[model samples]
Target: MRHILVHLDSGERTAVRLALATELATRFGARVTALFAQSDRYGPGIVARRAGPALEEAAAAAKAAAEAACAAAGVACEWWQLLHGERNHVVAETVICARYADLAVFGQYDPAGDAPVPEDLVEQVILNSGRPVLVVPAAGSYATVGRRALVAWNGSREAARALGDSMPFLAGADAVTVLSLRGAVESSVAGRVPPVDIAAHLASHGVTAEVDLVPPNEAGVTNMILNRGADLASDLLVMGAYGNYGFPFGLRGSNTRNILREMTMPVLFAH
Candidate 1:
């Protein structure tokens, strides 16, 4: 993860987001881009009500805030990308851009995800970007240093991308475990390819992973994974997001959908 693209909407500016970004950027010598989308809420009538001056002031404030964060971090900064449109559209566009990004970090509302959303904000982006999306729940400092980790591996592109995105932290992982929870997600043919390919991939990346092929029909797979990570005192969880075909995503299995909605520690996900 040499470069990280940060979503600087209302969510990304939180202290939790800044702390996470700086921690990882400093850890792996990565560049951080605090990207704000200079968007109007919605509707042209709303724009006509108060658009230009209001937008300019908000944008200036956001840019200054992002620059100040970079200055504090002593990391290189690129605050030049301020996209505009509906909030959801800009986020969707950012996810598309994240495909080229090494990693994408951002803060989110709260545990319940009750934060007012325009619509389909997370699933659309995280599912399509093919990049790992890290969610910083609340305002608290987060870093990969001296942290244990739990990884969700299913031998899928989304999962693989997230695992690779986490290599920097995985290398620094005090303890790491890979959990393979296969449910109704795969077709019978998909079972043909063993999930061990993911373990091998992680091994190649120098991640010392302890693989666990949990038994099926095990209720609360997410809880089980979390329990295991908690047993090891892990602070981060890595997983590939699954979405139903509705999100224009290929892997929206129940597990992926459940994990994101019920996130515990910070989760790194790729769609």
Candidate 2:
């Protein structure tokens, strides 16, 4: 939580993203970097040529807004702009920037408009950057995060990795609930590991956590997680993105896709 890299774009959610980033920076006394990617008009098309000026203006506006917000917050901040011709270039540059950041923040996708960041940017960054990403929902105003967290736990490699990556936030949280759905633990095994083990592990790090076993509900796993998150009044949801390399079109685990599509609270994801 020392250095936070935030993806800035010309979208309605940019304010929410910056607010959350600045909030985190203020909490940890960290530096925030607002990154804007301007696409180059190199294609042989009239639309591409016409889009150049609009894109530049949009990027400039976004940068100005971020700077003003960061200034008002009285936090150390930096602005970065990169010229890219394709979506892959933006992703590559973002990944490179994320390498120097302790955490990366992004806004949820909005498919209705020509957003500066790609619709699948968060998924790509999580899979490629090897860093934790905090995705702010596109529709809400979050005043506080990492105060109370709900960890979506399962006996999988991705889940374990996400739990480990969320140590920084969890350690500072006032309460943490580790939720494991039914059938997550193997009963027939001679030595079965339970969600309590995860709580114990967090306790070892001085983050006292409680284990909660969720029964089979009609809402399915994804909805159950979201319902429970709302029930607990959690500001943050910690979970692992379950998908192979090159996701968004590839085969994504059902729970991961559902949460990405319908998350109400900010979610910390790692893969």
RMSD of model 1 against the true structure: 4.6
Q: Write the per-residue lDDT of candidate 1 for residues 1-271, one digit (tens) a residue.
A: 7888776654443546666687778887999877665356442235443334545555677678777877888888887453455565556666776676788776544444323233455566677876678876554456543377888765566666677777877888777888875443454456575554556776787777787876545566667877887687778888767734212223437776666556657777776
What's the lDDT for residue 212 in model 2? 87
| Window of ten residues with lowest summed lDDT in model 1 | 243-252
Cα lDDT tens digits, model 2, 1-271, are 7899988877777888898899889988899999886344442135542335666677789889999989998888898876643667777887788777889998777667456566666777888888888988877799779889999876566777788888888989998998864243354342655434666778889998888876433246777788888999999999878743212233557677778899999999988
* Best of the candidates, lDDT: 2
Model 2, residue 141: distance off in Å is 0.2
The global Cα lDDT (0 to 1) of model 2 is: 0.77
- Candidate 1's clash total is 5
* Model 2 misplaced stretches (Cα beyond 4 Å): 38-51, 113-116, 182-196, 215-219, 243-252
